[model samples]
Target: MIRILFFILIVLALGAGFAWLADRPGELSLIWQGQRIEMSLMVAATLLASLISAILIVVWLVRVVWLSPHSISRYFRARKRDRGYQALSTGLIAAGAGDSALARKMTARTHGLLSADQEPLIHLLEAQTALIEGKYDDARKKFELMADDPETRELGLRGLYLEAKRLGANEAARQYAERAADKAPHLPWATLAALDYRSQTGQWDEAIRLLDQSRAAHVIDRKEADRKKAVLLTARAAEKLESDPKGARDDAQAALKLSETLVPAGLIAAKALFREDNLRKAASILEKLWKHEPHPEVARVYVRARSGDSAIDRLKRANKLEALKPNNVVSLATVAESALEARELQLARAKAEAAARIQPSEGIFLLLADIEEADTGDDGRIRHWMNQALKSPRDPAWTADGVTAPEWLPVSPVSGKLDAFEWKMPVAQIAGPVEDGNVDMADEAIRSLPPVAIAHHRDEPVQKPVEKVVETPVKATAPVKVEEIVEQPAVKTIAVPVPTESVIVPETVKTETKPAPAKTEEPVVEPFFGRPPDDPGVRNDSAKPLEKTTFRLF
Candidate 1:
C-alpha cells in the first residue's frame, strides 16, 4: 500500500512540474561549427527528456542480457532443491509410517538431487532409511558423520544416544547424553537421560545438580524437579547414613522438607537422628510423618527411638502413633504388637481382630495368632489362627518393578527409577482347588474327623456346638461306614476316622434302627491327639486286644 501511494505521488509531482514548465515558456538555440540550429524551449526540453528515457531503457536491457545465464542456472538449481526437500519430507513421513521400501527409494532420490553438505536433512533421511532397513552400522556411520557438523551436532548426539541404548552400551549412551545436555541443557530428553545416567551410577550429587539445571532451563517443571531432588537426596542420605550420620541427617531432613510424604527420607532422617542420640528429635520427625501416612518403617523407628523404655511405655508411645492415623493398617498392627509385648492381651486381641476385619491380611492373622498364644495356651485356637493366616491375603510391602522388599528404598534396583517403591499389595493370583477324581475319598475322610472346639480366651460367651446328622444304612453282608464330618464356612472339611464295620450312633431324633451282625473284631475308637486321623502314629507288631469305646457326637 505504501509503495503504491509513493508511486502515485511521484507521478502527480511530475505532471505538476510539466504544467509549470509549459506555463513559463522559454526558447533555446544551439550553434554548431557549420550550421545553426534553433528550436522552441518546450520542444527542446521534451526531446532531451525522451533521449534520457531511451538511454535508461537500453542500459536496463544490457544488464538483463548480461545476467541471463546466471539467472537460468539459479532457476534450475532452485527447482532441484525444492524437489529434494519434497523427497526428504516424503521419506521422513514414510519412515514414520514404517514403509521401509518407500523411505529408501525417496532417500536415494533426495540424495541424488541434493549435495550432502547442502542439505543437513538429507543425512537424517538417509540415516532413517538405513534404520528402517535394519542397516544399523550404516545408520551409525551417518549419525557419526553428522556429529562432526555444527548444525546437526545435537541431532546426531540424540541419534547416537538412542543407538547406544539399543545396543546396551551404557557407557557410550551416557557419554552422548552428557555431551548433549552440556551443549543444550534446554533439551528435555538429553537432560532427562543425563539425569538418569547420573542417578543409575550412584552419582547423587551430580544428578541433583543436573536436575537443578533442567529446572532453571525450563526443561522440567518445578513440581517434578522438587520430587526428583527429594528422591536423590534421600538416596544420598541412605548411602551416607553409616559413614557420616550428620551429613546423612541433613540430606534426609532436606528431602523430607521438600516432600513430607517421602517414607524413605523420613526413615533415613529418623535413623540418623537415632544414631546421633537425638531420640526426641527422631520421634518428632516420625510422629509428624505418621500423621500424613502411617508407614511401618516410621513406627519401627519411633519405637526404636524409645528402645530403653519399658513395654508399657512403648505401648503408650505406640498408642500415640496410632492415634495419629487410627484406621491405618500399620498403625493398628504396631499398636497390637506393642500391646502384646506389654501383656495387654485384651487390647492386643481387639486391635488385631479389628485390623483383620478391616483388611484380612497375613500380617493381621499372624498378629492374632500371637495374641491367642499369649492369652491362652490352647493349641486349638493358635492353630486356627495360623490356618486363617495361610488363607489370608498377603500384606503390603515395598514393591518396585515387580520386586518386593521388606524395607523401603528410594530407587528401584531393577529400573533405577526415583521413588519407584510403593506401599501396596504385591500382585498375586490365588489358584482354585485342584479337581481330581479322588475328591470323594478326600471328602469321606474329612467327614470322619471329630469336631475339636476352638477355645477363646476372651470373656465372651462360649460358642454352642453345631451338630449335623448324616444317616447311613447298613447291610448285613456289606460293612457299615460311620464318618464324622466337621464343617466350617470358607474352611476345608476335617475328617474323623471310622471303622469299615463301625456302628452308627443314633441322634436324639427317632430314626429307624438296624441291628448289626456280630463282628469277630472289636471296634476301635481313634484318640484325638491334635493329629489328623489319617496319620498313622505307630505300628504295634505284637498282638493286643482291640479296645471298644462308645463314641458320641454332641
Candidate 2:
C-alpha cells in the first residue's frame, strides 16, 4: 500500500512539472563562436526528455551486467554449506549412537561434497564411530590424522586413552591421562585418573600435590580436598609411627586439628601417644573422641585406662557404655580384658559370660581364658576359653577383615605394664629320701598357661598413678553374684600332689608357721564351677623327700 501511494505522489509531481514547463517555455541557445541560432519551445522540451531517458537506461544496463551473477553464485554456495552442516550434524548423531554404517555413509558424502576445512567434525565423528564399532585400527588412523588440528587434539587423545583402557593397558592409559591432565587440569575425569594412578603407585606426596592442584583449579570441592588430605596425612603418620613416633604423633595431631571428627586420625594419634607411654594424653584424646563419636577400639583403650579394677568394675563401666550405645563390641572386649589386668579370675570369667550373652565374640572368651591362666596358672581354663571361642558365632563387624578366627590377647600385655605379683608358696628343706608310699593326688594342681597370660615384672614402680580408669559408671542392675567371692590369707606352702584340674583350690591360705589362734575361720568353699578344696591340715604320706610347694617373701 505504501509503494502504491509513493507511485501516485511521484506521478502527480511529474504532471505538475510538465504542465508548468509546457506553460512557461523552452530555452533557445545561440553559439557565440561564429554564428547565432534560434529553437522552438516544443523542440527543446522534447530534446531534454530524450537525454534523461537515455542516461537512465545506461545505468540500469550496467547494474544487470555487474551484480546479478555474483549474487546468484553466492546464494547457491550458501545452500551447499547448509547441506554440508546438515550431513555433519547427522553423522555426529550417528557416531554418538554407535551407528557406524550410517556414520561412514554420511562421512563419505560429506567429504565428497564439502571442503576439508568446512567439514572438520566429520573426521572426528568417523573416528568415534570406528571406535564404537571396535575397529581400533581405523579409529586410531582417523584420530591420529585429526590430532594435527589443535581444536581436536585433546579429543583424539581422550579417545586413545579410552582405547588403551579397553585393551587393559593401564600404563598406557595412565600416560595419556597424565598428558591430558597436564594440558587441561580442569578436566575432571583426567585429573581424577591421574590422581588414581598416583595413589595406586603409593606416590602419596605426588597424589596430594595433584589434589591440591585440582582444588586450585576448582576441579574438586574444598571439603573433598580436605578429606583426601586427611587420609594422606593418616598414612604418613602410620609410616612414621614406628621409626619416629613423636613425628607421627605430630602428624596425626595435625590431621585431627584439620578435621576434628575424623576417626582414623584420632585412632592413630591415640596409638602414637600410647606408644610413647603417654597414657594420660592418649586417654584424654580418646575421652574427647568418645564424647563426640564412640568407636569400639577407643572404648577398648578407654576401659584399659581404668586399670587396677577387677573385671566386674571394668564391665560395669563397659555395660554403662553399652547402655548408652548398645551392643558395643569394643567396650565388651575391653571389659573382658579388664579382668585379666586386675587378676580377678572370677570377674574376668563373668565379663566373658556377659559379653558372650550380649554378642557372640571370641575375643571375650579368649580374654577370660587369659585371665584364668594368669591368676590360677590353669591350662584347662585356656582350653575352655578356646573351646568357647570356637563354639561362639562369628561377629563380622567385630572381626577384622581377612581373619578367619580372632585370637586371644592379654590385657596390659605391653612390657613394663604387666601385673607381676608373685605367689608365696614355701616349703621346708629336705634331708634324705626314704620310702615310696605318699603322694597327695587329691589336693594340689599346677599347669602351664599361654604366654599371653604371663606378666613380666616392671623394673621400676610407677611414680605417677596410671590412668587406667578412663571411664567410671554407676550400676543400674542388681549387684554381681558374690558366691564366688572368697577371702583367704596369703599362703606360704603346699604339701600335696598336683591334680589335672584348672581351679586353684582353697583360693588362699595363711602360712602354718604364723599364730593359729588369731582367727579360727570356717573352711572356705569353692564356687559351683571351681575345684573342691582338700581337707585342711591333711598330712602327706609321701616319704620321697616330700616335694612340697614353697615360697620365699621378698
Candidates in order, TM-scores: namely 0.74, 0.53
Q: Tens digits of per-residue lDDT for model 2 on 166-213?
A: 888889889988988988888887887787677656676787788899
True-structure Cα RMSD, model 2? 21.1
The digit string of per-residue lDDT tens for model 1 on 331-408 reads 888999999999998899878766665556677777877787777644445666666667666777889999999787
Total residue pair clashes for candidate 2: 14
Q: Which 10-residue span in candidate 1 carries the lowest summed lDDT?
A: 508-517
User: What stretches of model 1 exceed 4 Å from their correct place?
Assistant: 1-53, 428-554
lDDT of model 1 at position 232: 93
The residue pairs in collision within model 1 are 446-495, 447-484, 448-484, 448-495, 448-496, 449-495, 449-496
Highest lDDT scorer? 1
RMSD of 1: 12.0
Q: Which stretches of candidate 2 lie over 4 Å from their true place?
A: 1-70, 145-148, 275-278, 299-327, 340-554
